[model samples]
Target: MTMLNQMKKSLGLLLLCTVLESHADVLIDVTATMVDPACNIRSENSSSPLAIDFNIINSSELNKSAVVKDFSLYISDCNFSKSLAMVLNPKGGSTLSYNGKNILATSIDGLGIDFTEVTGGTIRALEMNKKQRIYPERVNATLYRMDLQAQLVSAVPIKQLELGEFTSTVTLSVTYN
Candidate 1:
């Protein structure tokens, strides 16, 4: 080939190679989830599961508002100042009341357990899987106290409630942001 044609082809090939070398075929992106540290939770500073015994609940006492017991839970060992939320999840299935309230169903038929939170001297019913901000009795590095009340609720009339030993379970989950 002529000298000028050969020089032109070489220059074009070098330019193409330069362009191809400067371009990237694969790109890498780094990603991560930056999450705040989690806090510890316990039932009154004990590692065991919390249990409430409603001893000898009479069938006539089963109603929408018959309280079985009141209890407290504690959260501690938190290093973050961010807000914390909690969820009350029933282990088995929950019963829906006639008034459209969610109640934790017991082993007995038509009878379930309901929970309420006592905050600022006002009582509020707690719903299943609903996130609630933890208004700690005192926010600090130490223990935080949370009060809860359990009530015996029946889907049917009190007379229709099964008369025998009954038991129920609830799982509490905590999250912080």
Candidate 2:
């Protein structure tokens, strides 16, 4: 056979064998309760809004450094004793969209916020940063404390800092499970 015909024949045989191969299908199903969990937070300090303020800094210093602050979440008085953890759902609409790491997304030009999962840590990209699990064993057990730090980062190159307000607001909802 000619080269063209020989190549076509080989291709057809490969396709036919591939189609004749055996195969099986698999399926997965998931279910959950429609009723919400009775894990209503027993504390009330969840009202006060947490704010991170990076007081005015010399543009030169800001361009070369990061400003960090500590913040906390307080929850108390669980109806029952149990171990629970919290997950934060930071509000979207930020131009600094986080790619699932621990970086904070911001809209302010030349600036971004880095969040560290608790105090005494490096600022991280925005992700489902969870607070350390807490067990409420008593009516007033040590309140659920989620200590976190927010750092003001400068994305600008050295000595290219822009002078202006650098701020980001996220309406995060914490779910305990």
Candidate 3:
């Protein structure tokens, strides 16, 4: 081959090699999104069961026992005035007594479950256990821990507010490892 042609080919090959070498270090951008379930409350005035639905996404990885510590329920009404009274029954073969006198808290604010009256609806560390006791012979039952049914008693009758809506706001928080 001619000297000039050979020189030209060499320069082109060297340029190609330089381009390939420069492209070796790649810059990539990555991102992801995490979604969690929405939790809320439900209730009724008459002597009926209060059904609560917990929206749990990626529940497979959840340790039910560990997560229960962070679980809580705050039943309150409008005007932010009154909270439905509740009682705590420890695990033992106890008698079934629904005396109006066995009320835990007067207003939702009086209930020391959470910190504050409005926002203090949290179930504290001490309140949590490996399992919850709902009734007699039903020890270690799952009824009280995750899903619970409580009878509501108001100190004064639940008078109808002009708002015309009987509502209970429940908030659930979950902390996992």
Candidate 4:
């Protein structure tokens, strides 16, 4: 309507934008309660260990195929009032060396664990860097299952084969919408 009014509105808009921008994405230190989960994962391991062992894989085996183990993250007794999502911590709980593809770093060089979500999609390093494997589902009246697969892989060209143990534990957390 008026030049002065228009200038004032623009200034207000600029101030609003600056304020919003400054307030964006503050630091977050996440802590999991574990005391109450919308649902509980059921597995045979009573000690709360989700692990797989590739017993003494040869160079050829590592080169040819990836050793894989199947595990399911079953959610029982879901009490989510709204939709929920399950995210696997990008670091997988423990920080171990990683191959180029973000697979678990092995004790010996040129070895890694090719992690994937058989039921969902390919596994990446994390949500921010790569696509984090997340399973989102509507609040259901029954149990929900997320099946995952991991493989022991070797680089195409074998440099040196060292005998050692490779292990990893991934931490998982939940968020609601």
User: All candidates: CA RMSD in angstroms?
Assistant: 4.2, 16.1, 18.0, 15.1
| Model 4 spans with C-alpha error above 4 angstroms | 1-38, 44-47, 77-86, 90-101, 120-133, 136-140
Worst 10 residues of 3 by lDDT: 130-139
* Reference-based lDDT, residue 98, model 3: 23
Each candidate's lDDT (Cα)? Answer: 0.75, 0.55, 0.29, 0.57
Encode model 1's per-residue lDDT on 92-150: one tens digit a residue: 65655645867788887787777888845677778777887766677555878778888
**How many Å off is the CA of 4 in candidate 4?**
65
lDDT of 3 by residue, 126-151 (tens): 12122222211111322112323232
Candidate 2 residue lDDT tens string, 85-147: 545454664534333344455555656676655423433333444453443323245445545
Point out the higher-scoring one by lDDT: 2 or 3. Answer: 2
Clashes of each: 0, 7, 2, 2
For candidate 4, list the clashing residue pairs, or say none.
92-170, 93-171
TM-scores of the models, in the given order?
0.74, 0.53, 0.24, 0.54
* Candidate 1's TM-score: 0.74
- The CA lDDT at 30 in model 1 is 97
Relative to the true structure, candidate 4 reaches a TM of 0.54
lDDT of candidate 4 over 1-177, digit per residue (tens) = 599999999999999999888855779899865644555665535347665666776667766666678776666665555555555544533323445444454555666566566555545333212335345333356766666676766653565656666555555554453
Tell me the deviation in Å of residue 3 in model 1.
21
